[model samples]
Target: MRGHDLINTCLPDELIVEIFHHIESKSTRDACSLVCRRWRRLERLSRSFIRIGATDSPDLFVHLISSRFSNVTTVHIDERISVPLPLSELVKKPDKGASSSSALKLHYMKENNGSTSAEGDFDSLCLSDAGLSALANGYPKLQKLKLIWCSNVTSKGLTSLARKCVSLKALDLQGCYVGDPGMAAVGQCCKNLEDLNLRFCEGVSDKGLVELAVGVGKSLKSLGIAACAKVSNITMEAVGSHCGSLQTLSLDSEFIHNEGVNAVAKGCPNLKALKLQCINLTDDALEAVGVSCLSLELLALYSFQRFTDKGLCAIGNGCKKLKNLTLSDCFFLSDKGLEAIATGCKELTHLEVNGCHNIGTFGLVSVGKFCKHLSELALLYCQKIGDGGLLRVGKGCKFLQALHLVDCSSIGDEAMCAIARGCRNLKKLHIRRCYEIGNKGIIAVGEHCRSLTDLSIRFCDRVGDEALIAIGEGCSLQYLNVSGCHKVGDAGLIAIARGCPQLCYLDVSVLQNLGDMAMTELGEHCPLIREIVISHCRQITDVGLAHLVKSCTMLESCHMVYCSGITSAGVATVVSSCLNIKKVLVEKWKVTPRTKRRAGSVISYLCVDL
Candidate 1:
């Protein structure tokens, strides 16, 4: 009855549809589908159609198309959930029109065969022939097709599909096994393509890219070809010559140089975002970007180790409307570059200076005073930043919404307090691997940051139960990670249960002090918990895990790595009690053995030593 009252009142059908447009997650909309018929109608019509996750059964699509008004325009299958290792092959042009799936098939690792790692019988990319035929027969309105890491999707099969789907706009072929021929077929077929991301498409050479530039030059708006190692001035020159109206271009890689930059400057007058990462771009390239691409708003120059304040100052003097800037790994930038940014760009909202250690707290203070509208700031690997710099940020940038100070080990709890007391609207805070912050900072955050939805203090050794209690009391936190924090135990877990009832994702793994009682508390309190990782927590025996399964209904992924106490019965109970359990993590290899309802899919976690 209480839950019924809390549900938002529905508006008119059109208004509800408009409201649903901004909701990014498909699962949330699926849940709302049960609310009312009007909501279902609105969910279908909502503009954003980003489908992501593990439950992408072929039947789901078949069901979706049969709906009254199916409007799933965009779908994104992220690797975080469903890591499809398909055996896909490109169909050559000869059999493209006649063959159903061509010779190309993306075959995912059929681990049902019991192959362990890549050491086992590696299956080729293969998609179901029936599914491919179904896709070709139906869904002609599909605009964007992202075959990311789908190595088996052959060019011939794509060509056939391309012929049927005339309205295709965007295509991402990143990490695919396709070559120049595949790109050529795409260029010939997908005429209305506006965005093309070919990152790590290693087979593509100067010729294929040139063909694409000539074919989709006028139409292509957003193009990302990051890490295509074979690229030279030939590709960029063609892009500059043909793709004149290009709005976004990512060339932040090793293979391209300033000649490409010069060509782009000469041709593409409307480029708004340009990424020239790792290119041999000296001050001359900056001059070109400054003088030619005046409409540019975002400019990321990673690996510009030789670049100094002069080059940045040139950009600042020229591109006054620039809003977002990333100079990660550019150690040459100092007070002069900082001053250039402070003086030139008043609309600056996002700034990242990772590895730029020369400029100290003073430069950041200047930034806080100037860039008041700044929403996202990342100082990853910036060693010079201290408590004073953070204090200055707290005082000046009251509207700062997100901050990431990962790997900056010098600052302590004082900085976190300052952030909590000052930046009240902070939505996301990630101080991962910052060893200095402790319980005091956690307490401050719990007391103040009323709207914090994401918090990660991973590797912050000094944090303990007090911090967890504070976070729990804060109530609104949805994601929390205290991984590698050894001091926290059941007290902290109790605090989390008492305070934050809306927690969906949690990682308290490697916290040696955390015991079975805390797990029981988490299970009881965080009923809405979707993902929980407690690997290496030796204290949490099967009894505690059992308690958790009994309490939390929606436990999807349970990671109990190195927690030898979790035996067959405990795992079986989770398999039974947590009906949605799709994956479980153990020691090394992920064993996706059958439980009851859903078969476990993936059980893998990796964090390379830094």
Candidate 2:
């Protein structure tokens, strides 16, 4: 007769599971499980992913995984708590005489009493061999596992997991202490593993990597090793000789040199993506890559100054399929090398040139002329680039979609206007500290770029309210950031609020001219606005903040700092008015313990120091 009884009695178990499959929210599924015994069983059967904290009770965790969630296949155990604590609990002060560390120890002891082995100590608060053994026994079907900052776990625990979870395909051991023996066990047992990341695993060395390469052999497809000092050219040789099917490899080490890279290029002909950083490599290594790895599609070289135009030219001539290339801090690279790439790699779609002062108009012009299909371009701190280069690019690359210009002092209004006129399909544009650009350029963008949704102009003192007003009248912007644009005022913001009702994210920080009128307009028109940053807007007062909070009920995040007119009362009003507010970043002086307590468990108050 009742709604609940009708649903329970009418719907079959199979139909209920079909409906459950459509519900993706974990909280909704958890609530459903609490309804009845049948729903709990069904929910557990449908759930496949779970994340647990290392500090959780080992016994209870094993019991829950085995009995409640039998179908789980992906598990993540992190040393950090899965659920963030309430602001009140996070900021709560300890007793007068007791230190915070002592209080934490006492809490840990109370929560984990009798849950650890006799050999356990302070370090035992984190997951250890005992927990891994329990997980192996309970979740034998686990396919993916991520252990983050679980320093207590060693090779012994990994061996236990590998022996049972033979179906594991991906393992991420970021910041773990596992060394050679553990990697050897995983290599020997988990033959199906395809992806492995050992970033920040300081204890691993050449022997471990060699064993892993030998055991996994051709099954391994992706490998990432970074900041492991003990790994050297030996590991590279082993990987090149054994892992013939490898497609993706990223290495960030100071020890690997030309010999190591040459081996990888010679062996792994199917490699499609390669990233190397902080290595003392020469032109010989790059030349080897160009001649051997013809299937390479993506290559990123960073902080390597020894390679010159000759090496890059080889890469361009050989790797015809290369589509994405990024060069950063390569001081020797000039127009000659880039021109070679532009001439050879016509299919290139994305290019980023950063901190390379030698690259200028000639290189960029070559890109505009040859790379007709290019869609994205980013130039950062390239001091030699001027409007001449961009003007050519704007006229040539008609299909360009995204452009990022940062700290390029030589660029001016001519280039921006040219891009606005040419790139009609542009969706995102970011300009930072390009002082020569102003209202004329932005107005052109507003008039021409009808599909533009994301625009960010920071520290460009020349930009004013007219630019924003034009954008508001023309484009349907979803994200707008005018931070550090001193010329932007309330008039511009009001126009934006009235015109772009779909605006969801706005950053008007450091605008001294903006006031309450802009906030009122935003609250009235932009009902969907969810996040706002009004830091350093001294003209804004509590009256405006209250008005904004009262109307914008969907506001989820509000960041207010250094606003001289706003007080504690304004912060309290925001906490109480916006029911959906999850994060409030405010000055430390304005928020008291009482306000934080009132925020309760759902809202997080991040207090910033003055």
Candidate 3:
């Protein structure tokens, strides 16, 4: 039997729809659609997500998309033009007798004090209210919508959409021009809205937020308001009074203070996660949180200084259910605060401390002794934390799975060894700029942490081939990054290739000693390798790259910046050999425009940098 007959006889419409539902690749689905009318209908019906750009004829594009994908529940309308026109084409000289629409728009905008209310300006360059109306009229079943940087879309457009798509549950208006009126419309119309993100919406103020809170009320579960300078205490108070069912709230505004936060804590007893940034909140707010928000599980605070140990102590004594905590740039927080938290919040599992220089060994030791369930810990720029803190943590936190230490100058081999010996379940370890850590520590990690799958040691000059060799021998690593580790050479890499047959992602950039031998070893053993970065590996030639591409047929990306030994022929070999190669980043001197064109035919993204 012919292939078509066999397929038709075996695969019914229901089975084909199921197959189409599982096919994620848009290009493959498009190809299937072209095969027959039945497939086209199935593919269109199966598609639930569609992304539209403003560069197309807005009304026509919306009409076609909404008509074709009637069942699409999620739509992302981006402001970015699909293809940017060249300067030469856009810079045509004005006619002697006629005025350009852009010139007239500019004049009108200037007259209106630089306002973007001119409808003509949005007609050609952006998706206007007319297009939105068409979209709303066509896709009434739309449940989720993301309007990213769609500055032309005003409250009128939003009102139209809210009136039509009543079932919309999630809406993200990041970088849009819509303000209180649009939010009010959404609150009044979209009764089922549960998640709303208005980050970077400068025009949204307290009044709009109050209206939204009143409208959505208890149904609003998650709300994000960041970079909205106009939002203040009033909005927070309104949210607290109305949105009692809110589970997650993210606020990044300088106007919020203790009173607002206190209101939220007192009103929203069910609040589970809260993220506050750049606020002038003090211990009073935290005290309220500890007293009222007993169910709070996650709290992240950034750029906070006024709050001291008192506030943290309140949290520790109150919020015992806390599982995740992140404190960044909290310069005023000392060991006392952390100790209090560690002692009380025993359920804590993940903790990230960034730029908290005052937190030293005492706080971390306290954490280790008390927070026995701790699984993930990240310490960035906490210079005072030495081997003592990590030693205690390693000894106590047996369930630890991931550890990230960056710019912690005091950490050394002692800490690494202790961690390796104790944390048997460790799977991911990232050490960056901790100069005191060397091969001894890494070797200990490899020898003890056999479950380690991801390891990154960047700019730790003391780490050498010995570390990599140990890792290769013991751990079946899938991701490795030793960038700027000057001591790493081909021997270490070759050892890794032989041992880590499952290695898929590697970054050996700036490893001057890496050459053809390591590449040959990788090609021979690591068949699953999909992405590699050999940037600044001066010794690697086209021959080495060829060896890598030959066997690693699954390679999807190759970055070879500043590798002088690799020529156009080597690049051509990669493009030809690896059918799955999607991206190639090479130095500009090696490839001409013609070469780029040829490479572009096979690769999805070709970036040439000087």
TM-scores of the models, in the order given: 0.77, 0.91, 0.90
The window of 10 residues in a row where model 3 has the poorest summed lDDT is 106-115
User: How would you encode candidate 1's per-residue C-alpha lDDT over 504-596 as one tens digit per residue?
Assistant: 999988988888888888888889999999888888898999988897988888888787677666766776787777777664333335542
Report lDDT (CA) for all predictions: 0.74, 0.87, 0.88
lDDT of 2 by residue, 67-180 (tens): 568878998877776545422243245678976664654454456445456555455556777678778887899899998888878999899999999999999999999999
Q: Which residue runs of candidate 2 sit more than 4 Å off their true CA positions?
A: 1-7, 53-67, 80-82, 85-121, 600-610
| Predicted structure 1, TM vs. truth | 0.77
Compare the candidates by TM-score and give the number of the best one. 2
* Model 2 residue 319 CA deviation in Å: 1.2
lDDT of 3 by residue, 394-499 (tens): 9999999999999999999999999999999999999999999999999999899999999999999999999999999999999999999999999999999999
